[model samples]
Target: MFRLNVTTLCAIKWDCVIVDEAHRLKNEKSQLYKACYQIKTRRRYGLTGTIMQNKYIELFNVFDWAAPGCLGPREHFLEYYGEPLKQGQRISAPERFVRIAEERKQHLVKVLGRHLLRRTKQETIGHLMRGKADNVVFCKMSDLQIQAYRRLLRSPDFQLLISKDLPCTCGSHLTRVECCHRTAPDGVIWSYLHRENPDGCECCPLCIVLPCLIKLQQVSNHLELIKPSSKDDPEKQKKDEQFASAALGEDAVLVGGLQQDESFMGMSDAQHCGKMRALEKLLETWLSKADKVLLFSCSVKMLDILDRFLVRKAYSFCRLDGSTPMGVRQTLVDSFNNSPSKQVFLISTRAGGLGLNLVSANRVVIFDPNWNPAQDLQAQDRSFRYGQRRHVTVYRLLAAGSIEELVYSRQIYKQQLFNIGVNGTSEKRYFEGVQDSKLYKGELFGISNLFRDLLETVFTSEIIENHEERLTGIHRTSSEQCAKQGLLGEHAVSSKLEIEDDIENSELSALSQEQDGIEDEIESPNDTQSCSESQYEHILKDAGVLYAHRNEEVVNLGGAVQKHKRPKTKEQICSMNDPKTLIPSFVVDEHQRLATPSTLKILSENGQEDDTVGQKRKYEEIFKLEEMDETTKWFLSGSSLCPTQSIDCCKAVFK
Candidate 1:
């Protein structure tokens, strides 16, 4: 563990070397494995529960590490035992497969059993009941998420990655949207390290493809991790801004007491994520019984999101991630096990999966799936390992048909592959897909397994900030509405404040403009002369929606449905527009028929969504967005009628 220099390491090893968790030494190419291979020892022991995680090649490497030439060279091992074992896993005919596997089993045990010993609890004891329960709960992706996923596949920019029509610019606009309904602010570099490799040369495809693919992966799990990056055209942006700004104004309601507003408890970002929703349901059930739960995710971003959620839900939780210092991991683990109040332990899969004792918790939710089945098992074993008294139930939440499903499938293959080498059993199910099929190449992309490379570059951190601002109400309260309420007109609201609020909405115009075929053509107010009754009904309905549940039957008295006392501060205004009452962005976009080309393409491809994908939003997409003058939002005329230059009233000194 000291200086990694070979001379320093070779000098000390004279008698014997024991490698704990010896499966790690399965890779002969790794520097650590190579270093351990160098230490001179007459007698050595390598201890591991799983040696050949994926291929028999690793088994050969480990045998070589412990004893030179024990299994011969890697090539020799592959020819004699590895190829036969692998072929046995792929054999389709059951009778023939099992017969060959039986023959190979005898040969493998005889050859390796001399230096290796593996025994299950049942093998050692006559009969032993298992203490671990594994449950896989399939989750469905939101329609918006599924649409974004399809868009990533077909977007001309993405489909033509290196083409002249679509240069691999820093901004992977079309692809990142697949990861979340939101993504980090634009212009922010996702990674400086990805700009170059260890050799300092520009990374091939990695610089472009990896990040966008990761963004999509994030979308598959939870949108809260990455802010949505899709931008609307300027015109669409202005209209949506007007809607969000005027709809809520400064009357947004902020619920200070989390418990006081039980209705809003479910309104948090947790529901937007399928895994989070499932997790909350699981936690509520377990925590109700006072049982502890360990929740693990590979994404620290997701962990942070969960942390915020648990705190909001008022559940006691402890978290450990890559950012968490190694020195404090044990302390946190102890705190969880020792404290009766800590019911949830949020853990990072890579760090928390290695070797941890978490027997105090009996319920586990693997927040996301992992490609490596062994790592997930290690993470789960934290509770079900040894000291666990209660029967541990581990729930692996996977998006039903999404990439998470594929990853879990791959994990099973790796696991079955491992079993073949150790137990010589071809227990693989027929529909599990081929092991080592490698790339999930799409004919549409003109590429082989690009998605695999994308998935391989494990995501580290995703930008996360509370996007509560964008979730503000869509009822845009205009200057006229302000005047009707005897409130300060839109003029009183500072232009800078208005601009900041519309920062995200600004991009809405760009996206909306791009989808010209879809954008609703606004008709002039004069075009609606004949349909007076219908227009009146529309106005009345709009007014009714504007104020919410107030009585619309006004009698020119102190009461009016849309009437409200003006808010004092922006925060209170936003808080007043209870997020609970706010429309889901997807619903609004749908109602307005503001779907982009990508969304339309996905919809057409899918044709009709099944009931399982859930019902389409009932609120019709807006047929038309009233065109407002460009200067109407930012400035006001100097006329007395106008609420400009802080003028309280217009006495009209004319004539």
Candidate 2:
């Protein structure tokens, strides 16, 4: 009756109804929300730690269900509360609009205060939880992956997908005057799967925007996921073949245009993917220390790759995904927790992120990032929450300078949105020019970033520095600030809740101390010194890393201060081989530095450097060279300037 006749139960009148995980009903259009709305009750109660996740309308839905007309009609609430509050959060919104939005926000909060009793985990159970450190690992893409990525960008289908002004590349289909080179022509409409070419039928037979994106994401993780296999369902394979042709062009090799070399295909899974290589190193270190791990990925196909890799390594692991039977899930979880042989528990972020407590595993790996930051945060909490023991360390892996970075930047945006709505804290506007709504531009928003040719610089200092600053800001919110903002309710001050909170906090502290002792025994002095640095330094040498910080020291890059140059020590100055001694230290103008090209070559129509235009190119190259690379060629050509000042050292090695 509970499963099949939920609506029938709602028909009967009741004095009250209580809802758990009430945020699920945020979408008013959902069947659960509809069923819950149909229930006849005067008093409706909703309970959820996270009442609002992404948008403001969510608050309205939860509130309206609890008390009819409390937030007024949906349209009224949106007009007064939603739009104004969102507008004020924007960096560019007018002063008047910001003022109006603030007023609306205050009123909304006051109204919420009457009905809502919100309490934070820190306040209620801070004593019971151990210290959890979140480290963001930016992994570089394999050489094969980079080639495939560039191949997709060069495809005609990709050009048609992003409706923005770009130099026309369609050979001979239209003249220089009529080449649809400007922003897509008026009335051009694009569906999620397919896009209409502005110049009509001359474009590729299939222009799929979504598939192109999925392919890039797949390449970032593992090229084998997109590689055609006989195991694929016939219809799915047919669709994939069509997409491959459209995305990579008919003449190009499939799956990032990988070479059909036996050597390439015969490479080990870790050798084929950069993230896998990092994971391999981490597993080696962790498993040796007898530390269990919970690894999560958004893609089930990626999990299959991991499963195979684990089998090759002869590592005992248990897996759970959407396909895992409900009855067997608990058994698998118990086996992983109780059995010492089970070294790792692999989980699908969507399937295993919630409800399950894997307290036995102290380390967690978010193999890939999700667009929704909440999903990733939830995955981290599985190990960190009211756990049995140990300090939880979460490693969030991202493909540096790829589409994954864009996804993560948006995650930061969405998180700021959540903070504004719930915690009443607003962050400095980082994505100022990058509009997420319409006419998207800037590095974080549009097609220009996707078509970026230079892999040398993935993220500008402004982008990565701002990203790190914003993350730090989010985690540093104090309980006093929350109280001043009225997020902490009257109920939180109750003696019973306060007593429980104290007990939990003490337990958490005790667990952390115990874990510290264990970690000290496991890692040696040198290992502890470099514990914060990326293990795969060779591959990530040119990648942008978002370093974590602890005790005023950068925690993810050998505990160095994140800067363009670190103050040189006297011992470092004695070695003439040190690049710092080779060139005079000077700060280059960021704007002028970025504008200068890495090389003095000019690409002609056919994508080849043309020596034929040497006269004009020669003068330009000479001018650029005189202005740039004087202090250090390494600084001018480095991938990112946010963390570590090793560019001079790298230059010294070459000299």
Candidate 3:
């Protein structure tokens, strides 16, 4: 048996050792290969389908691990084969270069073949099935989302970054924004530009960019994630400490826009994300067939959005993210795998990728693409490994015409690089050439012509000019969104809810007034001291079950009983709601027959001159439609018209 940790493996003597993905030790300079070289083994088998990513020396290193010094010394091998093969790549004569490269390649392959047992998928098991099928889905950005995206691109921070001519950073930002429709908090951006905390942001430009990117990812999932402006206050420290002391729950997480009543549980959440809409439809179809789904995103912030969404949707789910304490993480994983009630496992790629066996879920949805494709691949393998019996299908969601497309393309390039190194694979036509110098350039995330047009649209349209609050979707919380939007005249949902609470309190106060009026109506217990005691019991009963003591003496105020108002039912709501704001008008059907144009009142004769003038044109339009159709059509076209003359003379001639 072989171990991945080099030190442990070296310490244990083994009769036989097998290393998978042996190319990991292709670098002789790596600690893994050096430590592994010291391991005592009677027979070592190095298994890999990919070897020699950059040079032939990689193949030499792998062989050295499997059977030490079989390919001669590292330096000698490089001088004999690696240098010539690397130089031959730049050689001018194609045939000559091919001959020189092939010779070196054959020698390296011969050395590797002695210790390596290699087989292609076709050669190993003819027509054998693969467990995973990759799918890419493109989501359309909503009109409002598009407007917010353009406005963000035009922000001072983005423009300055462009002016500094940093393409790679721009590219990085683009990749980030493609997933979630956000980049930085507005306060952070404002602070960086002004060197002032107008929005209470104290972060630097660099700090702002990362959070902005995180928020953007959150926005792509749900607009409400955009965090509002906030500042730490020392005055509230005592109150906060006291609140913390009264531990009601393990966490004090307040996810906004989520009502405890499950009222907003349906489709309203999907409006902010096209992907969410797509996912809802997908879930409805797949879940009906009893297919369990494993949904994953790299950001826990995104997983939180999904968690809230799944709960609102009433989907039985289990979650495993970084914050899920180690003890509970596996329990959640096992529960999801075995529990029939749980249909979804909402997972963050980072937390769930390494060692969890999630063979229970047959379907996986990768909500966002990763820069390093292996992270996603590992996440997919979580469900496909060991206990899985079903053919696992993977869906990767991305925005159309977005940086995700570029990232997807880059993933292919990375996979090819791995294939070349581990399997000695070659391509006929390399589509995306790796450029070493481009890592620093902003052109990597270069604003395209389409992006520029969107920017121009933002400047020219009223969408950006007038409702600036649309960008609140770029924030992290509904409170921030509501505060900004409320000030900007958009619906302040929380403020309305607060007003409603005040109105309810006022109604309770009115009930207390009714209680006082009843006391005045009766004086039986009114021996001053006795009446005062009765009044105390009367108030106690009115306080409701929550505050009323069970031992308190009760008085039956039968005549003055207040009827408890029942919550409005759907039908009751419909009945109480008056549909009309204006008086309803009855259609006048003269003798139940359609009225002819001639029967209609000629309004030009009305006494109101201005009204008559407007009506005159309508009358002209009506009568002008009749008789001499060709002549009428010609006259209306303004052909051969007497420009100076009133048309009465020509009309008379026609008559």
Candidate 4:
């Protein structure tokens, strides 16, 4: 119901929490069980038919939620009820488990009986359906799928098993390449090592080499068509033959070459597509009417099928899978809640079962059930939480009478175990005493085959039975039908009207612009050219150029001028080198300028003529100088004996 939706459920703050098929919460260590236990509620109720299918510790999860201290610590509980065994054998605690189950059940009732409520479908809702949901089982695989699988199995390299340290039955120390079954040559091994050597010696050749080889072979086979053929031309024939020989030299090389060319592009394996399409169609029909839906399956592959359908329908949906990034989960939930256009939310139980609030949907559908009832319930609770206002309808789609049924039956029986506990019995005795026939009868049977069979039934019931009346409503030809209905004429008239409107608008704009002289201005070349030139110059300046020109101008003044005469010769210029002529008269009279007025007056008052006095003084000084030795006289002489002057003077006078 809408009131039971997850949002409302969480909002109402119920005093008790009831989880149907409670065995799913058996693992106390599981995230979902832990989440349930953490819920702040006064009472917790779990309804299941089978509780502990695999191990006694599975009950710890339920007990931990219903009564935290009743089960004791995991270590203490295991020590009391768990069994230990040597390697290569399974360990169980059947004898000690039965006793514990009985004691725990009583304790559970005493503590939580007032709030706990549970009933089987047979006791409550049995009359709703005839017997049980029918299931069909089919083992169908296309040739391509089989071939692919066989190729994988035949590969000597088990890359995944080797690289992941996965369990392997093959007992060989030799590398995949060194194995006798391996076709790669020693040289090829070296090449692979050189190109893509393992990080460490710990690598298993099966994991690395085998997968690579298989992928390469697949690629090569796919690309074979594109490979140049010898038969295409005589010139290429020789090359092709040589290449063929080289390729055939070793099995590994051949395989590698084939794989390298294999083309997965634009190619779909028909079987996978067909199966996927079938699933999609089924989903499309169901979703057409269903406001909210939940699809569950043990394998993520089934979810992929639904994903393709959602994509084809252009339906906005969110996917929760093992590989989904953790950060995006809450964002996706918020988007789904806020957006009504979003239709489907694909969730993987392992990743999304616990701690997720998906109360928007009122309907929950299980694509398939696994061995754990708790997992199925958790998936259903995604939509069946508090806020669900409508009556929640849960659809458990099963393949009747298949291994799926076996898993389902086991889940139910296990839930019952939790409901009824063992009392002081050995673990082995507890399991040995279980009624296998009763347990197996409850499993979901033939679900896969049932769907396959239902395809025909659906088509007949939904389409073929009413085909005649539907066909009579329309003409045979699609075009004729449209025309007869007047749809074609309406479409044509609409298109013509749109074109006419566009043309009229264009004419009106031209006329208005012409009247305003806008059109004439637009058509004028001078205005356009001037605008363009200005724009061009502006662009150039913006591009960091101070000046930009398209042409160069030259101005010439042509005239001849007369040559000037040479300057006077250096001899002529030096002829006037006389000291008296060279020295200014003021410089010669510099001493006279420095004399005092009294000194000049004394010379005048003494009646000494200026020239005679100067001559007498000069002669006396010369006589005094001559009285000394010749060397001293020469040193004191005012004039030199050698009186040679410039040749220029001699030349000028002689000439």
Stretches of candidate 4 exceeding 4 Å from the true structure = 1-54, 60-270, 273-278, 296-306, 322-331, 362-371, 389-409, 422-655
Compare the candidates by lDDT and give the number of the best one.
2
- The TM-scores, one per candidate, come to 0.55, 0.64, 0.47, 0.34
Per-candidate local distance difference test: 0.49, 0.57, 0.47, 0.39
User: Best candidate per TM-score, number?
Assistant: 2
Off by over 4 Å in 2: 1-3, 92-103, 164-207, 238-268, 433-436, 439-456, 464-655
Q: Candidate 1 regions off by >4 Å?
A: 2-5, 91-102, 119-130, 156-209, 228-268, 431-655
Better of 3 and 4 by TM-score: 3
Q: Candidate 3 on 456-541: residue-level lDDT in tens? A: 22121121112112212222243344456533122223323333344345335434743442211111121221123354334322
Q: How close is candidate 1 to the true structure, as a TM-score?
A: 0.55
RMSD of each: 30.4, 20.2, 30.7, 51.5
Q: lDDT per residue, candidate 2, 51-125, as tens digits? A: 876677887898888887888899998788776766665545576976686566557766776787766654455
Better candidate by lDDT, 2 or 3: 2
